[model samples]
Target: MTQPNLPLLKWAALFEGSSLLALIFIAMPLKYMAAISTVVKIIGPIHGFLFLSFVAIILFYLLTRKLPATTTLIGLVSAFIPFGSFVFKAKYLQ
Candidate 1:
């Protein structure tokens, strides 16, 4: 069987982490403080997509046994924490 693409997973982690940061730090503030609901409308779905994609890729790695349980667990759990994905990537992927 072929191996999973670690580089792609790393990139997914980055994109997912950045999107979360943007949503929380930028979009949410703009929505609440500036009454610009459109920012949340735009960023929410993008973040959701990236989050799902990142989780899916991590699950793929887990199922294929490409990564250990602890690493995969970190990858999955990190999705909920701000900048967690970046930390996971730096710790594991690098």
Candidate 2:
């Protein structure tokens, strides 16, 4: 059986993934290299919020939709690694 498509999760995953990239690539570089900490101060909390939202959405789907545990594990792992969410969406969320 095919799983239901979750657009919210897809968007959340995208946002979370981009935020992580922004934090690591843009924010960190500016903060450390240019001695400008303001960018991190702005991006860090945004990334954190996006990450939490992504995890919460994953948990909600796992419980309510009865998704496989491995999917949940993959979703959670995706939140940590930059761009992992995009891969997860392409592979699983389709």
Candidate 3:
């Protein structure tokens, strides 16, 4: 299998970071401070899609790059926890 391109992985990481920031800083705050249900209603689906995309791209990277099984398992497991992608980025991506 071919190695995962670093550029694509970097882009995916950046996208995930920005989406996470939006969800945490903008959307969640809006829900609480402004009492706006739509904030969550809108951001929830957007965040979900981005999260799924991140996982899909990460899996693809693992397959193509032939990353270690333990690393892949870590990445998959991290997806379930809040702020877990940040941990994955810090530990694995860098």
lDDT per residue as tens, model 1, 1-94:
2234499789999999999889999999999999999999999999999999999999998898888788888889998788999988888887
- Scored by Cα lDDT, where does model 1 land? 0.88
| Model 2, C-alpha of 50: deviation from truth (Å) | 0.4
Residue pairs with backbone overlap in model 3: none
lDDT of every model, 2 decimals: 0.88, 0.88, 0.73
Give the winner by lDDT.
Answer: 1
* Model 2 score (lDDT): 0.88
Candidate 2: list runs displaced more than 4 Å.
none
lDDT of 2 by residue, 1-94 (tens): 2447888898998899889889999999999999999999999999889989999999999999656778989988977777899988888887
What candidate 3 gets wrong by more than 4 Å, as runs, is 1-5
Candidate whose TM-score is highest: 2
The CA root-mean-square deviation of candidate 2, after full C-alpha superposition on the true structure, stands at 1.7
For model 1, name the residue pairs that clash: none
* Candidate that beats the other on lDDT, 1 or 2, i.e. the better one: 1
Task: State candidate 1's TM-score.
Answer: 0.88
Clashing pairs in 2: none
Error of 1 at 9 (Å): 1.0
TM per candidate: 0.88, 0.89, 0.74
- The segments of candidate 1 whose C-alpha lies over 4 angstroms from its true place after superposition are 1-5
